[model samples]
Target: MNVFEVTLQPASLKNIVIIGCSGAIGKALVEALISRFPDASIYGFSRTASFHSLEKKPDKYQEARIDYEDEASIAKCAALAAETGPLDLVIVATGILHQGEITPEKSLRDLSAEKMMALYQANCITPSLLAKHFIPELNKGSTSVFAALSARVGSISDNALGGWYAYRASKSALNMVIKNAGIETARRNKSAIIVGLHPGTVDSDLSKPFQANVPAGKLFRPLDSANYLLQTLLQLTPNQTGKCFAWDGQEIAP
Candidate 1:
């Protein structure tokens, strides 16, 4: 299916959460979710609770702070969200590609153990922890999704022109986490879907430095990427869980 199309939602989506709402894609997703599900409660979170900066906020929206590296902060937020109602969707929109002194290594000689750990913490551990706390909060009676941003480079089988050791490896670990969570969640609720999303090199700080290499029509705006990601979620079923898909709804082979 073309994820860009506004496909009719098959599941009754009610409550949603977007982690890393301070980021470009995360903030756009919050706005998309509000527009797509006007009656649904949106719990947007970031280290800064940046949703307040949005010009047009929704009445059902809730903004809060979240330290992505802290398990306590994630657990607390999950508990608070659960208290309101069952979760319909949880989007872990956080990732680290280039920030501060961290950049994708061009060769093995440039690899640092500390940088690898930092990448793993942001890309894999944080999202996996989010799943650990929030998966149970998902509505068990109906179809729901627990999705996090992954990348095309994460696929071990798809790796070509490999250079980014830490970022690629960390995202690969995240894909495993998604697969593991999907299996466990299936046992708990057969209707639940767990998967990874590849937003396809969005026009954001994360991809800005690397955009010079991107081909025409491949790079996307944050809002466009958000809608495409959401559209992929709305179309996916239980049988398709535990897999990774691109923004255009094309499955990324593991």
Candidate 2:
């Protein structure tokens, strides 16, 4: 039977939170979830003043105002969402690519301390902080997933091709935090799986420029990447916690 003909459906995951919901992948994932799990309630967060920033219409989800940079804001958002009951899934889709004042210089001669610190704050610190505050809201006795969008460039062993110094380093650090948290979370909540996912080179503002070097068949649209990611998440066993995988469902060694 063809893959689609096999009734590819996600197991019942009732409550989900998608951070950075206005972004391409987040929007796509939310749309897919709304269609696949009509009874499921999703909470989507975005810095944008309104949910209009997303291409998909909000169905069962409530658009939450969030600022990834502020701990108080994230805490408030998490608290409100948790009031609905135990969270089945928490996806930290937040990440930063480039900011003149926050990212490392392209050349060695232009390196600046300010830029390095900013990148660390946005890419590495923010997600780790979110895990600190949000993972506890998940149901303890049942299977739950906590996943963050990390990059393949983050893999120290896979950095044969190098250039994005700040982006690469920040994502690498984020992976470590996720791995460490996964260990502790497993001990605390055996049913929870914490994952670091690399969504591949999707056609978004964050990855468009880099796609020139990516082979034609390798580049993914946001919808395709999101669907594959959701499928992978569903297939994960509790033992897969702390593991990093590409959107293609291939393991990415730390």
For residues 108-217, write the lDDT of model 2, one tens digit per residue.
76666776777788888999989988898977757888899998989999888677788888899999998898889888887788889999888888876567888968
lDDT of 1 by residue, 4-56 (tens): 23322544778899999889999899989888888888898899733557777
Which residue pairs in candidate 1 collide?
none
In model 2, the clashing pairs are none
lDDT of model 1 at position 179: 95
Candidate 2 residue spans exceeding 4 A from truth:
1-9, 53-59, 100-106
Report residue 196 deviation for candidate 1 (angstroms).
0.2
Candidate 2 overall Cα lDDT vs. reference? Answer: 0.82
- Model 1 segments beyond 4 Å from truth? 1-11
Score every model by TM-score.
0.94, 0.91
Model 1 global lDDT (CA atoms, 0 to 1): 0.88
